[model samples]
Target: MKIEGKNVFITGAAQGLGEGISEALLERGARVCIADINTEKGEQTVKRFQEKYGQEKAIFLKVDVTKADEFESVFKDAVSRFGQIDIMMNNAGIMDESRWELMISLNVMTLVRGTNLAIEHMDKLKGGKGGLIVNTASVAGFGPGFWFPVYGGTKHAVIGFTTSWAVRTHDTNIIKLFILYQFQCSKHQTLIEMQYKFCTGI
Candidate 1:
């Protein structure tokens, strides 16, 4: 499906892969909200996109994904700015395996909260248009990480939640669900799955 004219809200969009996705989407004519805890980097991302894609194409929000209120506010702000949200990318994550609690909090709990908020805002039965919710999962989600059990578990939870939720809500016809697995495997594997399930209108 075409991404043109879509309004995308991406968490952890200040740098790294999130930033790259934002740039790609903007190039495809989608307006993006770059949300992250790093205000400096987030603003810089917005500035870079604005310079390349025009000032109206991007906005930045200082968001702490661990906070439900802040997470929800990003959605509200994006809607207020762009009229509606067409895509929600729950992409914020951390890799510190030593602090298991911190890892679970950021990787697992925060995603659960974000998914809840996204459903509330995007559910067609709730007086809103449907949208696509693309979650970021990793290869570790599907296999064991002998080196980092805690980190692996979080990603495993992500895949579990995303798949189960997708099946549970399958008949709703209100939102399209997708789990974009990070290509940590060989380059050949990357060509095998795009996992881009376009959100058909509700």
Candidate 2:
């Protein structure tokens, strides 16, 4: 899809990979809504973007992705601000083994919620323009992670969930779903590699 003039709603965009994605989108002339739990960093990121890309190019909304209400509200607010959302990037995730349940909630459940909202707002059959939903998974989803078993499990769940929706929506052709896998070489790995797959169906 063409990136210019597209409106993107992205989570965990305050820093890291999400921040990079937001910057790339803006550089390509897309308007981005940078949603994150970290208000301070999020504001700073948006400020920087606005200064570089112009004031209307980006906006920041503080959001807790694990909460259904807050997550849904971000979508509503993004649509209100941008007029319509053309891309939804579910990039917020954590790898906390101590708090495994929260990990599952943030990494898996919240992503599901975000994808659903994207479909609801962008499906052409529902009187809205069709768009793309990009879910962030990890290389851990492909195999065992002895040091971070729970984190790996959450990523695995993400892959399964996104692919399932991809198949479900194939016939309609109203929305496109994609899986983005992040890979790190080792514990001391500073560089991150990203791989994406376009889901056609099962």
Among these predictions, the greatest lDDT belongs to: 2
lDDT of 1 by residue, 1-202 (tens): 4689988988887987677667767767889998899998989879989999999999998988888887788779888888988888888888887788988988889888878777777777777677777777787888888888988999999988988888766554445454455546443344233312222221
- C-alpha-based local distance difference test score of model 2: 0.81
Question: Model 1 off-target regions past 4 Å?
Answer: 174-202
lDDT of 2 by residue, 79-139 (tens): 9999999889998988789999898898889998998999888776778777878888887
**lDDT score, residue 108, model 1?**
89
**For model 2, what is the error of residue 20's alpha carbon versus the real structure, in angstroms, after optimal superposition?**
0.6
**Cα error, candidate 2, residue 183 (Å):** 4.3
What is the TM-score of each predicted model, taking all chains together? 0.87, 0.89
